[model samples]
Target chain A: MTIKAINVRNQLRGRIVEILTGPVLSEVDIETAGGIVTSVITTRSVTELNLQVGTEVLALIKATEVSIAKI
Target chain B: MTIKAINVRNQLRGRIVEILTGPVLSEVDIETAGGIVTSVITTRSVTELNLQVGTEVLALIKATEVSIAKI
Candidate 1:
């Protein structure tokens, strides 16, 4: 139930803002350092149970989900 | 080619660390505020062409990619 956040160097990053677990898929709170809060759900069971607000979370998200953009 | 970063409210966030476009799919550099750098690719044509270092990027990642975990 302990899913380690894969650090994708030269990619993207975030912090574990919140942690909500369930019997089925678990939702992870990701607060993008830029001030955005993203709730990520996973089928894997998380039991570490040490997530808190402002905790560092990594987004090893795949390329299919992310794309280049200009602000 | 003006693709906007979809902000996943209550989800993850990041900055457009870099933007390298090609004739086809484009590669986006996302520096997670926390420190992880992730590259996201998209088939959509991004024409805004206004990305740079330390730019705010939103992850809008799907639940299937995110999961909860302890420290």
Candidate 2:
């Protein structure tokens, strides 16, 4: 598979429903227009970006590196 | 699948081969005693942990969440 500049492989269109930034990993909760499709956790998110609730963002993914779950 | 205290699931025993820390994320380079089986990218690893070269580590993985390929 082709590796992007960063590990972020594909741009997944989603809206930020919740963002829980703690002492460690930043959990950016996203909800796609389709349904409760996926949840992503990345170490890269920081408070300085000002990524607030109800923000529109892309859940960049590596198709080869993605895992799907149903809840 | 059981979720560990963290996203880290099953421990795929490996050794800390290398580590690259940048402003954004920490890239942990691990090599299994077996061979180049897998590589993991977690936002949780830090320099303070002193996860150094030849250090023993567990490349925890989620059974249901694992994807495999060759290099």
All candidates' TM-scores?
0.51, 0.40
lDDT of 1 by residue, A1-71 (tens): 55354443333356765667776756665655555445555435344444566766554555566444333
Best by lDDT: 2
Name the Cα RMSD for model 1. Answer: 5.5
For candidate 2, what is the DockQ-based docking class?
incorrect
Instruction: Give the poorly placed runs of model 2, Cα more than 4 Å off.
Output: A1-71, B1-9, B37-44, B68-71
Using DockQ as the measure, which candidate wins? 1
Mark the regions of model 1 whose C-alpha exceeds 4 Å error after superposition: A1-17, A36-44, A48-57, A67-71, B1-7, B10-17, B30-39, B42-44, B48-59, B67-71
State the iRMSD of every prediction, in order shown: 4.1, 9.0
TM-score (0 to 1) of chain B for each candidate: 0.50, 0.60
